[model samples]
Target: MSTTAPIRLGTRRSALAQAQSGHVAEALSAIAGRPVELVPIVSEGDTNRASLSEIGGTGIFANLLREALVAGKCDILVHSLKDLPTAMPPELVIAATPARVDARDVVITRDGTPLHELRTGSAIGTGAPRRIAQVRRRAPHAKVVDIRGNVDSRLARVESGDLDAVILAAAGLSRLGSESTLHREELGLAEWPTAPGQGALAVETTVDAPAELLAALAELEDEDTRLAITVERAILAGLDVGCQAPMAAHAVVSGDSVRVRAVVYEPNGEGRIGLDVTESLNRGYIRRNGSGNEANAADGADPMRTARDIGDSAAHRLLEQGAADFLPRE
Candidate 1:
């Protein structure tokens, strides 16, 4: 038997998952000074793509990997932060959140066509309820179809002449070096606020893991990203919503501050709520102490509690502003 021990890194079988896991594994290898082998785990999300709503939520993607970690099948699990549920199982913990990539949404079209230039009646494909609601609000004429699959499959649908365009996360395309497929004009944050934690990679481990491992993994934590996502996830949890709702939020770290924006939509383009909230970290309670939890008398007890407070506050304002009852009966 060989003397060296390999750390097993569990991930889904999709190209995006493999690419993401490979990147994380490389970092872990360099940090640990040892070999880390990626073990592809075919998840329920991969096998059951009939409908996300019909199954569970996007949490399906993280479930199996978390299971693998708990079962001693793997030492670590890497996930797209957006796909992970706000509340983790008691036994698992999000050990680290590395530096984030592009966190905006991008539109991909055939022949590199722009959204406005597409045929008036052309069909646009997307799987996200948030994207559909936002796209419909912007382009009321286009026929929106629900297209689900891995990134490659979704992009392939456009190339197969079945879709005029599709919306995807800019981070994924950047990671895969597939920017050639994007339409430059629609890549702005004003046009599309990304899903919470869209471009971030999260590392998860069993709660009972050795402190040495946790501490080692925690070295990769990006405080700016953790704070940004904390606010984003807070917005989501505040809304009492999951991936099923038409919700989008994004935050940017600007010199000891974070500017967060959130939006909610009705499916038929009737009602919407949006806000640009800024917190100056250097001037706030977080400046003295690293946690924003200190600034939450108005928001609630915790950071997420405050986020929920802000989300509800925004939702109520939107409702008052005549946000229509376009929420679908799913």
Candidate 2:
């Protein structure tokens, strides 16, 4: 591939998706010294008005974009990491994961009322099972409305008096610059761990992408962000649950250590199970070599392997606690 050739980036047509893709395109263009073009692709999730679970879970959002990539309609695809299924197609690879932003959900209300303070029967809008379960546990009296739309339309419902409040990912609002005007209260991660890979973006390309493109993507990757989401997604995979399941997993990497917290809730939110675990990383064995390539584990103690082990351990503990009983039957 020529260094000056334009890179076609495929993305969903939603405002939030476009904004996120635009950011990635600009960054890649700078790094690769080439033009990056946005190729908006409509997805099944956008066309279907049904709830995410009713249709096919959040994975519907990625199917068309992945197809466009596979068919050579685009050189790369940008996806909201949380929307992707844990089991990826064999032909594609997540080439880069940039730095993550806020991984918390926020409550947007017309009157700036806190989520728990909403009046009895007040309507709260959200389609995510995780958010629905959290809202029910926190404000049992409030009516949970399943909503499907772009961020602007969802917020419009609250402003138009159709809904008292709506829950959304803080990252989406931040990306779209929609948070400044809204009266939002960010939910704390400790009390409300968000879905795995929330607030992160995935840059994916076919496994056979040009070596130059792969090298540019490697320059775009952030080591810490990749490692953290790796643990979260690994936990999700180990649990054997789909995106629609009412499960939340969050992992944070600190100096030489990572902490992972996960929870599973019943659909009605009456019951739940959670676990918090932290493990130390052997930094001495997992430091980057002098060649500036990938980190070399001197003793063969890979950081990514450690992250997966942490997630797998947490999933096993949750299973021991009967966390699967809280989830919907397959």
Candidate 3:
């Protein structure tokens, strides 16, 4: 708990993960007046050759890091918010969410061709179910190849002519300083909503973390970013779908209002359902609890409460419109 001691930040060993964690470490060091060191941890997702769905989806990348945190191997864990499961360990808390970057996905092609312009049968590489569904819907002529690897390896496929293009998150490329060098076409969120919490980072620690560390982390929190991701994730949680579900939800906060858009797609991308809704926050309302339930808001006007309500409402509408029919059944 000493202010001079180095804060250990646990992170996945991937280049992208390290880059993101390093940024957070630098910020924390400046705020806490202490050294912040990276603690690289290898996760199952990194070692497994199988597809994400086959190996438990995105959560595979986070479980080991959470374990290390709980076992005291690291004082904190930095996670790509999208990779976290809806349910977290009871002992842990996501203490801070730095301001988010671009939440849009991008198509990187060998010749810089936009996705819609790709020739028939052109191979497009990506392993995420949401992207697979999106690509099939957006460019029916192109072939969707299930592929998995780090960003460099995926991009290398396009560079080596093994694949015509690959879909990747814009944020990952920006964080790794590879965006400018690539021939990418950004996918707008209006038509291609990304996974919940995409482009955001989650800094987590034990509920019992030292007061000094918690205070330092609070300095990193971005209220608007947290509220937006919270709404998006609430939709995911309300749907009760696994991380591999072909679903996308995005939320944006503007002034006193927040708008959320969500979609559900069939595995083949043939059938889909979507909803868009917005709500205004009462400036005078206050958050009363951490649990996202309605009871957490004193008068049902709290911003966080409004976020959860709107998200839950959107999910309920989707279900009513038979969104469940298009999702994978457990």
TM-score: which candidate is best?
Answer: 2
In model 3, what is the error at residue 214, expressed in angstroms? Answer: 0.5
TM-score of every prediction relative to native: 0.85, 0.95, 0.94
Residue ranges of candidate 1 with Cα displaced over 4 Å: 1-4, 53-56, 179-185, 282-330
Deviation in Å, model 1, residue 122 alpha carbon: 0.7
lDDT of 3 by residue, 1-330 (tens): 677889999999999999999999999999999999999999988898797656557478899999999999999999999999988789999999999999999999877889989999999998888888999999999999999999999988898889999999999998998753558899999999999999999999999999999999999999999989989988988898877789999999987788888999987888889988777755444564666554433554567777887788888999999998887655
Q: How many clashes show up per model?
A: 3, 0, 0
Tell me the TM-score of model 3: 0.94
RMSD of 1: 5.1
User: Which lDDT tens digits does candidate 2 get at residues 1-330?
Assistant: 567879999999999999999999999999999999999999988898988656657478899999999999999999999999989899999999999999999999987899999999999999988889999999999999999999999999998899999999999999998754558898999999999999999999999999999999888898888889989988888888887789999999987798898999988989999988888755545677788898866766678888888888888889899998877654
Candidate with more favorable, higher TM-score: 1 or 3: 3
What lDDT is reached at residue 236 by model 2?
85
Q: 101 in model 3: Cα distance from truth in Å?
A: 0.4
Q: Candidate 2 regions off by >4 Å? A: 284-297
RMSD of each: 5.1, 3.0, 4.7
Give the TM-score comparing model 1 with the true structure, all chains together: 0.85
Pairs with backbone N, CA or C atoms under 3 Å apart (clashes), candidate 2: none
lDDT of 3 at 6: 94
Error of 2 at 293 (Å): 21
